[model samples]
Target chain A: MSVAIVFDREVAERWHLREVGVWMFLGTVVMLFAAFTSAYVVRKSGADWVPVHLPPLLWLNSVVLLASSLTLELGRRPGATARAASTAIAATCGLALLFFAGQVQAWSTLARTGVYLPTNPASSFFYILTGVHGAHLIVAFGFLAYLFVRTVRRTDVAGWPYLAGLVSTVWHFLTAVWIYLLLMLRLA
Target chain B: MSHSDSFIRKYIFSTDHKIIGIQYILTGLAMALVGGTLAGLIRLQLGWPGLQWPLLGKLMPVGMPSGVMTPEFYMALVTMHGTIMVFFFMSFVLVSGFGNYVVPLQIGARDMAFPLLNMLSYWIGLLGAIVILLSFFVQGGAAAAGWTAYPPLSAVASAMPGSALGQTLWLLAMALFIASFTMSGLNIVATVLSLRAPGMSMMRMPLTVWSYFISAIMGLLAFPPLTAAAIMLLFDRHFDTSFFLPSGLIVAGKLLPNHGGSPLLWQHLFWFLGHPEVYVLILPALGIALDMLPVFSRKPVFGYRLSVYCLMIVAVLSMIVWGHHMFVSGMSPFSGEYFSISTMLITVPMTIIGVNMLGSLWGARITLATPMLFALGIIALFGVGGFGGLFLGNATADMQLHDTYFVVGHFHLMIGGVTLLGTFAGIYYWFPKMFGRQMSEALGKAHFWLTFLPFFTVFFMQHFVGLQGAPRRYYAFTTYEYLNRTHGQNVVISLVAFLLMAGQLVFALNFIWSLVAGRASERNPWHATTLEWETSSPPPHGNFVEIPTVHRWAYEYSVAGEALDYTPQTVPARQVAVTA
Candidate 1:
């Protein structure tokens, strides 16, 4: 018998349940950040709202995230050997981690420049949105790490492509959400 | 769920939707007792002020010092009661529990799209319940700033005793609940959307499935804003960021260090989820009633498409009506008018749904089964609750009625009454399916009358006292000279409330007794035409031996020239069968 949670006898053949599930999950992530955006706009309109210049490292991290998505696409290109596919995915995960390290670096850079969380409303929102997005990335990282290890071990390589697609969607979606939050802070 | 799985794997770490569903229902039952005791404490303080029970002092020494319930303690009880009843209890049983057990089976699927996530949702939710309950044992009492947790009081720790550690724990617990609800709701939505059996078109699915589908989607859309609010509130309380706490003059004659913050922003964020959160409970109750109306009335559901449309419309309207709750929060007159008009517009679809049910029951051979009785009761009580909304929906009218017993009364009927009736109806209706035994009809009928009568008296009296200007959230109304008559009504409401609680014992004992020794029933006891009835009394692992193909909509009762009164969705069309 197949897994109780993961498999159905007949329905899985008819539709991409995993893709649909990922799409629905993205809807919620969108709402969560949408709320943060609204709160930012609302709080920014108030007095004592001092906007802080974000650290320059964030631009580099954005490029790193964009690169990670690219390497993910590269890994899935046709005729890639098993070893090559594994190596590409490993590179993508490494870049994703580097991107997070860059985020922490940006926070420290802000702190060194005399901008703390409770220093002002804009600073507070800046810390919050970044912190929340990091928390979600941590969860995504865990899943992606599973995929990385699976490709290395190749125990579930047969189904790893399917799993890889789902995780990739989340990874790319978060990358887009980060860009949205980044731009909202910068422009809005 | 597999036969080869061990007891620990099959039952404890089970990913089976049925087991997870029972976990939700049973946890909700336990929390209901806790919530009910809190209510009893509230009524004791309000009904007969200063009445001391030494046992109470022994039970909770901090909240009730020397048998006297403190004002802060009363506030905590009120907050915890509302929080527990609405979020913990109702959402668990009706929304997650019923949705989990019924959605997969009724839609003719093996299990939820993500059953592992379903299990995770239940466990995380249980953790949240434990965290909230643990707040009572902390240095301060539970959250006192109302379940809404409107900021300034909720944000500032030293505002009250419960405001200290308890409120922080409340936010943490709420964050946990929202996370769990997010996962569970997504699972429900995905299952409904993607996992239906072949030939089970969206319209062919039962209203029970439709209601739950809409409720899950609505919850998924609505909860995140509150998540955003909770995150900020936690920051405000712990980090002193002043997200919801404005620059204040004095707290104990000392100036606070917080800067500019808008408490109204918290209201907007909280109610964005809070308004739909009410519908999250109620729309399912309405759905439960809508589906059952066909079963008991033995008639094709009146306006099946319209009922589904009404649910969809309500879901959309429920999102926008969050502002109606902020009418008295110093909103601009123009914004208030906009919110008010949109809020009233919900009643149009709601009224249509009600009329559809009444029309379904008109001149039909109604069963008057225990489930039917509770289902009918939900319809009547909902009408009363909806009528009260008309008064509160208007900004000018709510100016007098906001925070009054009238507002309290309206919600109690709509949320409290409807959920209570819906829970029982669902339990009775599905008991045979869940446990494979029928509950006692005599006890069920007795339970209905006992609960229904007092439910009417207790809440209905609030509307009267509210009209007379008796405010809510007070420690005791007896202290006010103008509220002297209101105190008398309070006592009556209290006494009847005791009866209403006592009435639930019948259901409890009936549930327990029926589980082991109630009358044995067949697979389809109701003779209903839903897909769930087509399976075994207790459906097995993966729900069906073979995936059943749906042929028609769920409600095909008393057809013009059919051999049977009802036809299961699995049955093929006569024309198709003949051609084959």
Candidate 2:
């Protein structure tokens, strides 16, 4: 007796389920940062806190991050021509690299000012926030690089749009996270 | 695709979920032995202070020199014991092991959503366990700052003997464990949500799947805070960042350089994950009992929708009730009252679950299967444990019983006894499907009675000891005049604990013997009405050769005018009507 099992793959609803998994993961990442930020705020209110000056280069890094997010979202448009999408994807990866380099510069500037991690709680939070955000950005960069390679080589192009869409969503989310972290550091 | 394939592909590097599940089960059982031995050492020092352990003293001259355990050594054992039991034994064996083996089959899916990711999860969890086990032989013993590892003590290396490298290893091990859990939890959630059979709606799924799904969601959301906390703790220990270390702290009469950190930050982060984790442990156990009770009693489960809603209610309430753990930690009176109310409110839904199980069993032909006995045991024991929580949940009462043996008894009855019994039931219920062999029912029943008797004897005696104000985590209570009067109870509890350890061997023997030489089993050995029993015993690589189309709810037992007493979820309406 043969029984036909109608899996969700045919229902065109499988992609939505995968997207739910990805968003659930991103939700966890949000909580991790939420915990860190809450701790940062509480620790800052302590009597011995010494606030550090914000890095001048951090503002430039934010612009780079925001621009990359825009380019990635444009690349995700279903109606975009292949050449247009490729260019946008390439530019997004480049801007992400520049943003990473800008963060390194900010760290060096802080070290030069003698505001190292042990200087005070403020400097500690600055390094920790930027370092963790940079780490996630690197993972996003690697993902975008994979999409970049696939688009350029035209290998496995059938899966290109979906893969690019996932990378774009993550890249955009990280961009927002960076802005939030920068604003938090400045306001505090 | 025969059994004679290469060993690596068949067993080691295979992406088969069944093999991965068995791998988790065996590894967890082995770690339980290690965790159990650590408990033995802890009980030894607690019962007979400074008594020389004749065999162990010669083996480890430092920890138990001349057979007499030191205070620090006793502490180290205590820390590792809790860590191993909670993370390795319970997390791996009870949740991941059984969940991996059962979820896909019960959902009528061919395999996990991501088979390779499922394989990686187990290996990573095993690596985390090994890293923690290695901490035992490290220079400072094994993280004696307690399993919670709170700071200023945990922040400074010189604060304790095992605070240096041992605590660092503990943090790393825990970080890896969180990673593994997050990955596995995602897969379970994804599989359950998307991979149900053709007609299996969310409500149509078995209570086991719902429990596993809810528990997985809890793990996915809760583990990240602990990961973040572990990273911060690592920073405080090594980089002198002082995330958990406050200003003007002095350890060992030396003024510390660290400043501007709040220790309460660690507690908030820890308990956020820790309390939800209690639900993560118990929900699966509750799921197992709820799933098994109807089958044994030959009746439809009472108030199925109510049972599911109660689980959802408990899950949400458990997240907010974490502050109850901090009632005596100088928290505000208002916050304490809030937490107290939330904690007490949880018992309402918990009571509903217990009543539903009893209601289903009422006026029914109850079978005395070994798994049924364990399922019923969980309800009785967990009910008592739930009542005990009210005392601790009350802010006023908790002030006196904060770190007493009463709190210890409460958790052991709930997380310790109930969860372990639930796992035993799952093992017995699924052993046939897992290995195509039947466990000795006589041996299984005997194992339950032996384990049940000794378990209560050890943990129940702890409540009276706590009433006498014998505080927890102290290696020797000789310093307190009131505690000396409780020494006789301590001896009895410890002796009974050893008997509990011995009782586990009956289970071990049955489990091992069944795998090798026991009688073979057939499909639906228990005449159950679930998707898992619809397939052949020890389901093949793709689960079902022709995937079933589930037509009704999981428990459709004793439908009027039917030929059989039970109707499987896969049976179509036409067939069932014709039979009726």
Candidate 3:
């Protein structure tokens, strides 16, 4: 089942179709979240839906997420040394940690407000949507942490940047989703 | 593209498309066994309404009381069987299996666009299949709200009997399945677009790749809606959200404490994904038939562009006509008319495809090989099935035939007929390329005709019975007087079903036997112009020794002054003139 064939590096380099493929894949994910958010708006406008109050901790979490996105963007700068990249990566990691902690605090705030998951549909959606989005962000953070370790160990920056860029895109997406969730809560 | 492979790298967890295709085929075969066994039990229960079957009674105690099938259990079987056959068997085997194996080889690429992602996609789909099967073991049995999993029934645990842990697992499995499809669709689209050999333009690529590429696009666009629907359903079930559950939804005299959700919204979302899904299930088969017809007929495809455009037209039209499924669900009469017109208009593309196929076969040296037999059978069955669409596509006719065995017959003829027959055509046509051995033509033809005749008998009779007022999804017909008139017809249909089931055994036997004892195939058995046949049979890990530089179209059979009717794609232009 083996063949002796050689690929021309020049030919392979001429068409970086993998980049286009990755973009398409990422675009699909964006559209999925977009559809979900649209449904959120339509469903929220209906009567008999009791809109729960937003947890104050979510505001802090949103700021933390925004800061994490900034740190990730800075880490990708051209002249950043290994140490400088790691420093920015560490900031992203720290902010992500704070964001997770803030999410937990927000859940507790809802609990203290007598808005348990099973108590009402509104609380349930609040927990489920945010919880799912947070879980995805956690996975993104794990990828970033891996990149941070590799960068600190002086791995080639070229190889790591694409992965870092993907993680940053997902992180930015999550930050936007959180803002949308907050708006939905406030309007409700 | 070239690689020296160790045994482990070549076979086990191999990145090779051929190996991956075999893995998918074997997995699909296993799932088909499970799905077919379930169908057998369902048919048995239907045939004998209350007869006690020993193992079945033990396995499905709630659904089968001393072998008597309950409605909930019937629904569960229907749902699981449809889910397994469609997603696990048909789509998996046709698109993932054949598409993975052939698309790159046919277009002279070394491998898929992203090999690692392709591997992950298959494993994720395998995991999803496992999760779906696991739902059966859970308490309250598998989801019984139909494969459509329409909400209110699917959303409320108290509404349907199987809406407990089983429903939860069903949603989880579906979400995972959508993720798997998304990954696979990305790979297919990327591979076809970026990996074609030099001189192989988009139009020059084989129709099989085109069909797969279009199907992947449709899946990418459509599956996310279903994923959203699944997530929303999950929230409704576990999180007590009213996404698909409306207020004042009373069940068992208790009003569900939910509000502001429209179940119709779920239907719209589900069918937006669902209708294109039918094409996703069938397009590969259509592509297979198109590829096979020219080879077996010793002619180029007639109106190749027209055929490709027909597939695109069908793909686009399939997205809009899903509302026809909701005609009887209390949609506005005007909406029904709109859906009906769009649905009927799809026939134009289908008719164009049929005419192109016939034109390809016109005045050509036809080889009635087993593969050609199956391809011809598809053309005939697709015609029969397409005509039946006219009955259901008319709003007034659909009003009379909706939810009846007529709809069942129509789909079985369309989906099952095209998918199964077309897939077999692909398997038989490509067997030599995939396995390096020719299948027994006698056994293959036997399998084809036997399967084909019984399929028509069973489904064709169903249309008549449906027109006589027999509804679908019923476990028993012993009591309904109108249905009682059709008992004899049911018996005959059951016999045909039994024969159809048995015919598959011949195919399995032929397929298995060929791998071990059949005649070894030539390097280019069919003298096909496709780049796939340029390589050795059972194509190497990297697919080709030297990636083929395509100089002509795929269908250059019987060109003027050619000594042979066909020429292999790898034949150099200089050699061809000398040989001729």
Candidate 4:
């Protein structure tokens, strides 16, 4: 008697399901920040509003985030070898940590300059928008760390690509959101 | 494999979608009891103003002082009642519970796409409910600034007694609830998009699954703004930030230190989510009615494609029409007009949906089963409620009806009536499949009539009472000379409301009795053409022993030359050829 065998489904096909879930989550995050920014704009137009200069470290933090996005893109490339992918992931995690440090420095700078949370409308928006974004990045970092550890151990390489793809998408979207927030704060 | 699992794994912490759905339903039922009790208290206060509740005063001494219901407590009852009913009972029970349990089965899938996430969503939702319930025991009492919790009242602690710790806990609870809902919404969308069984294409899927899918998408898009608003309000309450607090606000003879905030900002953010949230509550009910209508009428759903298109249109229109809620709240006239136009536009698709439902029943061999009667009941109730909505939707009329009993009447009829009837219909239709036992039809019909009459009697008259200029949210009518005439009507409404509550006892009795002692259900008791019927009664954990392949649409009823009136989606073409 002859028997037929079927191989397991590919990672991309399965990842499509996970990808849909992740994108929907990102969509909500975008709306959340949009709501915050719009409220900030409305409040700024009112009386008793005091505008404050944001700390310079925010620009450096933006650079770190952009760099993290680039490294994740490099890791997700199709032809990248295992060692190359691990190196890219390590770089991504390092840049993400650096971005968090920069954000903390910016907050400290604002605090030192007497721009406290309740001092003015501008400062409140500053703390709130960055704090909310930082919270989201904390979750992203946890996912990235998982991806990094998995890549280093070479565990389930077939599934690893899909996880990498999801992490990359989230990182890039957050990077774009940060850039948007920065410009909005600067110009609006 | 399911049978061998430990008891705890099978019942308590199981990742089975069906068990989690049951958990959602049971939790929602428990919350409904609490919510319903709150409503009873509210009606009691309204019916006999200044009358003391002898027993309740001792039990809730903090809220009811000296046997009389205090104004603050009455407000808390209103707030908690709306919050629990909308979030815990209506949305959680009808939308999430049914969507989780029935969507996967009806669409021929074993389970949700992310089963673990589905499990987590239920637990988080339960945690949120527990937190909200706990808020009532706090020092300041439960949240009292209305369910909307508009912030000037909610922001300052001195504004209301319940604004202190209770509002904070309320916000925290809502945040957790939003998280749970967001996760489940993602699960539903992903599952429907990616996990359909073979040959069950988008068009072939049941209307129930489609409505769940569309509502999930709406939830995903709508809930985040509410979360954002909650966080901003939390900051306003505690961190001395001024998100919703305006300048020079005086509460209890003290000027609030907050500045540079717009109260309208909260209104905008809230209604943005609020309008779509109503659709989120009703679409599942509409879906239930649409699905049941076809099965009972023994006909293909009238304008199947049109119904789908209409749902999408309603969803899109629901988003833009939220501004209608703010027309009399001091929003710009132009913007209010825009909202009024958009709000009226929704009736076009709504009318189409109504026509299609009525058309399906024309000249059809109807089965007046328990589920069908409830479905017909929904049509009548929803028709009345939808027309009441038109009166409130018009900006000109809304100016007069804004804060009156008319608004309350319109809202309760539209949301409360439709969801209640639709939920009963679903419970009846799915009872056999859910428990492997049939509910008694006689008790079901009695429950429906009793509930239907009292619900309409209580709410429909409120419109006329409101036109008399009786304001809502008032603790007593004796204070205002003009409102004193409304007392008699209020007495009648309250009496009818109590009767409605009593009628639900029949449903409880019938459900409990049928679950244990009713007749055993066959595999397909309703002669339905859906995949869920192809599975065993109270389907196994995997849902199907062998996955069935679909050959036709879900509503294949009364086909010519067939042995039976219905042809299930799972039937193969070869069987029909041999029969012919």
Candidate 5:
């Protein structure tokens, strides 16, 4: 009798799980940063705050992240060719790598200037904000790379557009979070 | 997985929601044993301070040297017990266990929206459980900073023996738990949105699904701040960042190297998650009771819409009232008043829920089933717990009661007793669908009476002693003159707590014995209305021959002029009319 049950996979196809999941994930990530931002505000109000200087390279990295978002979103627009999408996806991944490189340069510059994680509360917040943001972006990058491979190889493109759409959603969110962290760290 | 799949594929790696659900329930029960033992140790120290226990001495020579439990070891037991019971058992079983098992089948969906994520959530949660368990044998013993793990004591390794590696392991386990919840919570929310069967509107969905969905979102949004705080705490401990440690602190007659940290910041972040976390632990259980009550009473649930609204209202209000937990801290008076008012406001929705439960059971053909008894226990106990909470939620009353046994009693009655009873009801009500067998009614009723009486007695005595200003987390109750007066009460509570623990064995035995030999349950054994009972007992993979089109609301029982006492949500209205 159990064998009589026949599940239709078609009904499940309409399930926009990827989109729903990404949105929920974005909510969690936002809360994490919100906590960090609140912590920064409270800590900055304390004595011995000793504000750290913003890295010059961080400005360039911010542009790189913003540009990557534009490229990914443009590639995922309503009517892009598969080849164009593949190229855009790979380019976005490359640009993300460049952003990471710039962040590393910023960190090294801070280290050269005799500032470490424990140097001052300001420096500690600076490193934590950037480091945690970078950690999240790295996961986004891996997924983007997977999409890039799929688009390039044409191996599994059944739901390429939907997959690309989810990728872009997360990509843009991280970019926005990066901006929020930058502003919070600078303003506070 | 196919029927012919390998054993590992069928059981271990199976993405089947039912199997995953059973896995979570069993794992939670296993962790409960560990937690219950920890509770036993705590009671032993409280009841018979300096009492010799050579058996425990052999197990932990450092903690129980010469058969006498130290202040530090007693603390570790307290920390792990709270940690295990709250996170591993209640949260695990209610949210993940029943969420996975019941949501899909009841909603008429085949499985979770993201089955792989659901699987990962369970395995990751298990890894977290194992990590916390391993913390016990760590160099300095298990974490002793209480389950909350407030800082300075938690930040400085030299502060205490348990603060060293055990605290780090505790942080790691907590981080893993957050990640797992993020994964599972996301899956539950997405599944509810993306996978509900046709005709099952939001209002048509079972109360259990709504409560689970609301609770999952609460966990998802609330847990991250705690994650953020854990990261900062880790930095303070190892990297000398001093995120939560104050600058002028002196530990063990030594000036600490840390400077410029606010321990209050940790409390804000912790309770941000911690407060909503209370709702996350109980809402699903509450939903379970509300959903099953109608089936046993043979009456449509009273004010179904109001019940759902109360669930959401309670959830949203729970998020904002977190500041009440901080009233005893150095918070401003204005903020204290605000939190106090917000916390008390929650009682309105909760009162409405209690009223609805009683209203649903009013003048009904109340069956004396095991699950029904547990559901009744939820209403009665949760009602008392809710009223008990008013004192703690108010700033004027809570300031004095803070950290007292009153606080302990309040939570035990609510999160501890009510949630556990609710979870047991879920297990008993759904046992037929889960395992194709009916648990023994005799044993179940016995378990309920034994557990309910002792559980009520123990916590009630705690409240009495607590009102006498007996502080909690104290090593020796006999040390204080005021507390010494409550010595008799402490012994009674301790012995009753042991009885509560022993009663759980009946449930365990009933569960195992039923799995092997209980009578097979037929489809819709209770003549229920929910979609889950419409499927085969021990539902097959994908749950349905074809996903059912839900035709009506979940609670349809004993309609006037109806031939059958209940009409399942799947039955068309025209068919019901013809039958009538």
Candidate 6:
């Protein structure tokens, strides 16, 4: 029998099964965050809802986040060669760390503006919404950092796709949620 | 060495699915004792107002001083009892216990897709149970807000006495508990989809697996909304967020600083998860009933495809009908109409399922074994519960009956009645398979009859009290003329509840006694043809030593030309032909 058939029938069974489960879990998390963002918008439009000012640092954080996504993508490229791929992975982790620092700075800036979490309902929501999202991002970043370490150590590229796909998808989703929250803060 | 040999490592603390199943059963049994005792106290307090029962009075010194139940303590008992039984006992016992042990074995898999995660799921769930129980001793006592934990009442510390640290712990425990369930759901779905042996097609797979698979999918989709709701409520309490608290709200004549949040928002998120949660609790029992009815009837389940289709329909419809719970919440009029129509539409598929179950029992060799009796009881109780839905499905009727004991009766019959009865059926049916010993038929039948009579007596009367304007979740009612009329009925119901609580001891005694003392059984004592029956009793760690290649569907009993009534799945196609 051909190698493809042999592998497909034998080794692929357990691997494919695991992939389906992991993807389903990742998809569920994505949907959960998506629904929360939608609820945030709907609730933001209610009467007496006060809007908080968006921090400028968020724009810088967004850029760092988008760049991290791109770097992670580049690291996954087939023809990029090993050294370049490892460098891209390390850079992605660095930018992710910067993104986290930027978020903390943004919170500090908002606090200085007298927008403490317990000051007003608007401020309280701003902290909770972003804080929860940031906490999730921190978790995702930890997973990505682990992947980066493994990539630098020359772990098999085959396993990378699952984690890589999940991390990128979640990163993109977080970015989209931030944009939605930003618009709601500024306009709605 | 014989495959039946076992070491301590192979039994207790074992990663083996069978052992894990026994662990859940034993733990659930222990929790049931606490739950049952609480139920007895609740009934005693309700049966004779101000009656000083010694032990119960001593347990709740502040709430039931000399056995006079304070409303707070009564609420606490009801709240904890409901929470413990539904989450810890029913969900764990019916789904995690039975589903974990049987799903893989019946589908011909060695173990779950992720055995390590599977074990962790059980441990995390156990940890969650401990956390929840610990809330009883917390500063403010256990969470006394109704299990739904409606906002403002549940959000503000001044709202209720128990809305303080205890409620916070309850929220944390629930969040952790959902995480554990999510892990288990992922495992069940993955194992069912990917691990069936070579010839066991999805169609050939047993109904229990299908129900569990669908229930897992429901849990995956439904639980996160509740988690989100719980987190928002926590923020409202601890961090002064107004997510569920409206502006200009006055609590206890103190102008609450919280503003601009809609309480309806919390309801929307909660019911979104709550309605599907009913199915998550009931579907496994329904699956158990489906599996047992066929075996006892000695026939393939009537309309197997239709039954599966009904389960899918119910799962999807469950998501939409959540809005019905919001009917009285003063949501938008349009939303009420949408929820009302969707809620009624669920009955279409539910009817189909009921008909298929009744049809499965028609014109068959009905063996009135203990499991079969409970299975029949599930059909009857589920029918009563389902029929009662008509009163609540209509917006007009719901306006009258919402939050009434009628709704309580409806749910009790559906969930507590059908689900618990079906769980008993499963426990008795699978006892032999799991322990390699047969439970006492005499004790089983006596327990079933005692449980069946009291169950109906308690809940059947509840519907009337509900119709007569008796609100649920009320610890004590002021003596109005109409309310006084229903007091007699309440007394009767409480008496029956006491009996129902006592009847469970028979099950407990039977279970423990049978584990060590009952007669050992042959591998396939039930003479069933399911894949699980083909394996050795208390199956090996990897389940079947040689994977079974199915020649036919699980139910092939009494087929033409077969010498034996049943045909095990592992039997070769040629042997089937030869027997024919």
On the 0 to 100 scale, the lDDT of residue A124 in model 2 is 84
Instruction: Quantify all predictions' global Cα lDDT against the true fold.
Output: 0.88, 0.87, 0.82, 0.87, 0.89, 0.81
Model 1 spans with C-alpha error above 4 angstroms: A1-15, B575-580
> Candidate 4 residues A1-188, lDDT tens each?
10112124865667888999898899889889878877877888877777779777789899889999999888778777778888998999999999999999998998999999888888888888888988998999999999999888877766777788788888888899999999888888
Model 4 chain B worst lDDT run, 10 consecutive residues: B571-580
- Candidate 5 has an interface RMSD (Å) of 0.6
CAPRI-wise, candidate 4 is medium
Q: Is the docking of candidate 5 incorrect, acceptable, medium or high quality?
A: medium
Tens digit of per-residue lDDT, candidate 5, span B1-580: 2356688987998788888999998999899999999999999999989899999899889999988999999999999999999999988888889999999988999898888888888899999999999999989999999999988878888889999999999999998888888898998999898889999999999889999999999999899999999999999999989788888899999987788889999999999999999999888888888888899999888888998999999999998999988998989999999999999899999889889989999999999899999999999899888888999999999999998899899999999988899889998999999989999999999999999999989998888888999999999888678788898888889999999999999999999999999999988787888899888998888888888998899888887788989999999988774121
Give the poorly placed runs of model 5, Cα more than 4 Å off.
A1-15, B577-580
Going through the candidates in order, the fraction of native interface contacts each one reproduces equals: 0.75, 0.67, 0.49, 0.82, 0.82, 0.49
> How high is the lDDT of residue B327 in model 3?
86
Model 5: DockQ against the native? 0.75
Error of 6 at B288 (Å): 1.3
Query: What local lDDT does model 4 show for residue B565?
Result: 84
**i-RMSD per candidate, Å:** 0.8, 1.2, 2.2, 1.0, 0.6, 2.0
Give per-candidate clash totals: 0, 2, 0, 0, 0, 1
Considering only chain B, report the TM-score of each candidate against the true chain B: 0.98, 0.98, 0.96, 0.98, 0.98, 0.96
lDDT of 4 at B88: 90
For each candidate, report its DockQ versus the true two-chain complex: 0.73, 0.63, 0.41, 0.74, 0.75, 0.52
* lDDT, candidate 2, B1-580, per-residue tens: 2345588987898777788888888888999999999998888888899776778899878899899998888888988899899999999988999889899999999888878888889889999999999998888878888888888767788888888788888888888888888878888898998888898889888999999999999998788888778878877887888789888898889988888788999999899999999999999999989999989987888888999999999999988898998987899999999999999999999999999989989998999899999999998889888888989999999999999999899889999989989989999999999999999999999999988889977888887788889888988888988778999888989999999998899999999999999899989999999999998888887889877898888888888888888999988988784221
lDDT of 3 by residue, B1-580 (tens): 4568788876667777788777777888788888887777767766666777878778767788775677788888988988888888887888788888888898889888888777777778888899989998888889888788888879988777788778888888887778777887888888888888987888887888889999988888888777777878887877777888887889978988777787888888888888889899788888889888989999888888888999999999998899888888898899999999999899999899889989999999999999899999999889999899898988889899998999999998988889989888988988999989999999999999898999988888899999999888887888778688887888778778888899999999999999999899998887788888888998877888887887666777887787888766566676563222
Q: RMSD, each candidate, Å?
A: 3.1, 3.6, 4.4, 3.1, 3.9, 3.1
- Kindly report which residue pairs in candidate 6 clash with one another: B247-B260
By lDDT, the candidates rank as 5, 1, 4, 2, 3, 6
Clashes of 6: 1
> What is the docking quality class of candidate 2?
medium
lDDT of 3 at B274: 82
Deviation in Å, model 4, residue B176 alpha carbon: 0.9
